[model samples]
Target: MAGSSQKDRKKVGVFVQHECPLNLLPREIWSSIAVMVASNSIEDLFNMQATCKEFLGAASSDAVYKHATMSYKPLAHFLLHLDGPERRFLDRCVEVGNVDAILRHGFVEYLRFGRRDKGMELLARASTEGNVEAGYLCAMLLMFDHEDEEEVKRGVQMMEVIRISRKLESCSKFFRGVFNDAIVLLLEMFASE
Candidate 1:
């Protein structure tokens, strides 16, 4: 046979590599494997997402986001730039009880602190959904003593505005240490009267 052209050689290489180890697996099996492999390492999980569009779709999913917190900064940037569906995905992640997803990607503390009105705007939407834990999250962010009174007041108002009972209960249960500050503040307010 004549010597293969460089283009032909490249084509052969591509054909030989066509069936990536991931693509050959069934969808459900692939999802399971991705979940197992992505268990602890956020970077590996991110690289896995780059392997292919299918993998990326699966990896960016709530199951993966919950485990890896994959959608944080970029998701925030999307919102800042007005990237709608991407922002909505972050919203869904929060709605689905994805704490890691929210803390990992959604809440940009510095941005929130600097632009209090806009941050509260997003939190207000989250709160109206009755996302009580989200309410407490805003409250807790303000609980930091270093925050100014305006920020603290916004956080307290968020707690009062959140109508979700279950999340309120969860806030009281999971974050007792943080909740204590609110109680103390209320007591102090009463005592001063």
Candidate 2:
């Protein structure tokens, strides 16, 4: 958020001037702008990345993909159904430091594909690894996956960990409302115990 990554999205212009080569832009600026541009229009960002190797580094970055998926439902939804080969490609994306990708994989496996135990295991691992979305998902799954009070308490603790974090911005504004409702539901569940 600070230091090297400040307002990177701002640098990616809607249109780079015809007179100026993109290479002329500062390296960090160029990458940040490309990622920002990717945030809004992934196709345009991919086109820019396709222009050359340097742009590829920026456009294909974990931060870029994370921002894109978190910001756009279409991208997230598309990821939910990735077939084996596509998932292998996605595995590369996550290898670049995107824990969200792993979390999403777990989510799709658990929710959409009905691989419940596998999904729950991945979610728990990801949450322990400090992925906040994973923490949120793990909490929800724990609530439903068992009747054990200890599991419920662990889930509540996970929710509390994220509830007050300054990084709650990591969850999209749309998802935040859902998460808040979830917290309330968890509270009610805890009270019933």
Candidate 3:
């Protein structure tokens, strides 16, 4: 078999070792694994991407993108250059009460697609569920994007509500710090009075 042609080896029933362990996985299984990482950690994403071309493609597969969402800048940036069938994957982010998903979806709608009111609505939906970041974003959007005095006033009211909500204060001190900044904006708003 020495110096045999590539076909000769196959005739002898030689098992060829090809690709890495992860890459050897069924595309569906690999995508399943990759999707699990897409939602929570960029490092996990990069790790999966480093495995092989198969894994790299799997990392960006719609199954993974569905869970990952465009909230991640890389995913959003990647999706931007894509066309047709892949664009549908962008909206697959699950809506099952993941506040971050809600806020991130809102971010994409406003920043990427320029759908201001649509984005604000998504953020407001998250905020209503007691997400601090979502509330903060909703207030900011209302304040900056809307020219109506009523909208700014509504934003200010939102800030004040977020700042003092005992439910938020009790659960997340990190968010409490963020929510408090609303008071500064509120104070600045009222100071002109």
Candidate 4:
């Protein structure tokens, strides 16, 4: 029994050493080690990412989900309902670019605080593109409406700039108008300060 216990201890030591070897190791190997660790605390998870690119990439899976969870409970909970492939695709988004990451994190702000016109325009575009996932949210927003909420109402008015752009016949002109309006609005807001 003692001999068997010794073997088990040695096996555990080998696994630990293999994961976080003291000797200089290749980047890929080091990253693989980082992934093997199970972290329960958010602080430890972030610390692991800061350790190296391999760790960052390895933790990207947890990081993306964690970021979403911290930013929006509903969005995170909704994502959990997705099948395996969609979840895998989201992990890929974490690796490919920050755009998806930022959008996911900013979803609540867009939903609750963005100007009504801007939010509606964005939803219309999403609908036109056949984004079925956005359907439920689009319907809910229209039903509840931001006008009833003070903070959201402010965002709705600020977003009226979107309407001015919609008057143009050309799609390009419309976008250009939005860009110009954004710049002007920023300058005016800054000047007021």
Candidate 5:
């Protein structure tokens, strides 16, 4: 009976020693997989991280955060009130040049908090990174808010590019609503001036 138990134990140990094929994949491949998972659903990425140490490492990559489609709704709440982990996650996304993160933070900073320069800088960065909504907002700000003729001309050119690209037609309704509200606010600001 003791000899039979020893043989079973050895078989179990051998099975445990066999590595998963996934564990053999390169870190770059894992990172790419993590990015895809993150883009699909950040929640899934978080769940993946809990699966194993290897997945946790991959999910923590900056590339994952950069490509992740974070929920903008929670971000709005975070903006109004600081939440530690969420704030840190937002900061990581922003640091990695996540376009949506930049756009949201820029919009809030510029429109809500009156941090014009910083907001414009972030907006411009997001626009340069291929966010059509940020491009539109930046053009609007440059055209209406700046007194400099050169800045106005640049804004006009930017708007022209956006129109030529037809990106505005495909933009999300949420962004369009935000854009319209911003236009109204800008008009009010100028009217009061």
Candidate 6:
């Protein structure tokens, strides 16, 4: 009886390994699911990746990173102080053209670190990708800081587009606060000069 039970257990294990429903799903389906998970919370995405090799592969998809909604607080901390996995995750998101990541990184680089040119490049990329906050910041920076007349004209056009679209009215309070802070910082920067 014991020997037969052991044999049955072996068969069950084999069946479980070979017939897992999740394993049967296509990679594209897994990637789509990962994107949904990532859109909700990046922490949940990390937990999903820890589940199994297949999930890990799915969570690593560029679509997942691109669509992931990284919250502002943790992302800000990650940007100010580089940690191991968090930094890598941020880098991957930026590499995959995550708009929020690009915008925040650009803002820090431009305002905090004083790498204006690189920051502007990143901000422009994010704005072109349809990030409203990035568009606002880029417009402000170009209008206020650039010496070139054409650059100022371009910034005016961007601001005009944003105003006509009524995007400012739709902006979250958090983003509005950020815009206010940016204006103050720009004022301080010029005042100190």
Residue by residue across 1-193, what tens digits does model 1's lDDT show?
A: 3565654665444344466665676777666656665555445766887888988876766565444344223323432332354445455655666554454233443353466555554555554554565567667667563358887787667666543443566666645643454456557667989
Q: Write the per-residue lDDT of candidate 5 for residues 101-140, one digit (tens) a residue.
A: 7887787688678898999999999999988888988998
TM-score of 1: 0.40
Better of 1 and 6 by lDDT: 6
Ranking by TM-score: 6, 5, 2, 3, 1, 4
Query: What local lDDT score does residue 8 receive in model 4, on the 0 to 100 scale?
Result: 80
Question: What order do you get sorting by lDDT, best first?
Answer: 6, 5, 3, 2, 1, 4
List of clashing residue pairs for candidate 5:
none
lDDT of each: 0.55, 0.65, 0.65, 0.44, 0.78, 0.79
**Location of the lowest summed lDDT over 10 successive residues in candidate 1:** 71-80
lDDT of 2 at 193: 90
Where is model 6 poorest over a 10-residue stretch in terms of lDDT? 72-81
Q: Where in model 4 is the C-alpha error above 4 Å?
A: 1-45, 57-107, 121-133, 143-193
* Pairs that clash in candidate 1: 72-105
lDDT of 4: 0.44
Q: Is 2 or 6 the stronger prediction by TM-score?
A: 6
- Per-residue lDDT tens digits for candidate 6, residues 49-161, read 99998999999999888877665443344334556666677678899989988887787788768999999999999999999878888988899999999999998999889
Q: Write the per-residue lDDT of candidate 2 for residues 1-193, one digit (tens) a residue.
A: 5865775656665865574475677677766777678656545776887888878776766666554443343324532346663465346545664565667667777866789888887778767777777877787677767699998888777767777785445554535654565566657667989
Location of the lowest summed lDDT over 10 successive residues in candidate 3: 73-82
Q: Give me the overall lDDT of model 1.
A: 0.55
| Candidate 3 or 1, higher lDDT | 3
Q: What is the lDDT of residue 25 in candidate 2?
A: 76
* Selected candidate, larger TM-score, 1 vs 6: 6
Question: Best candidate, lDDT-wise?
Answer: 6
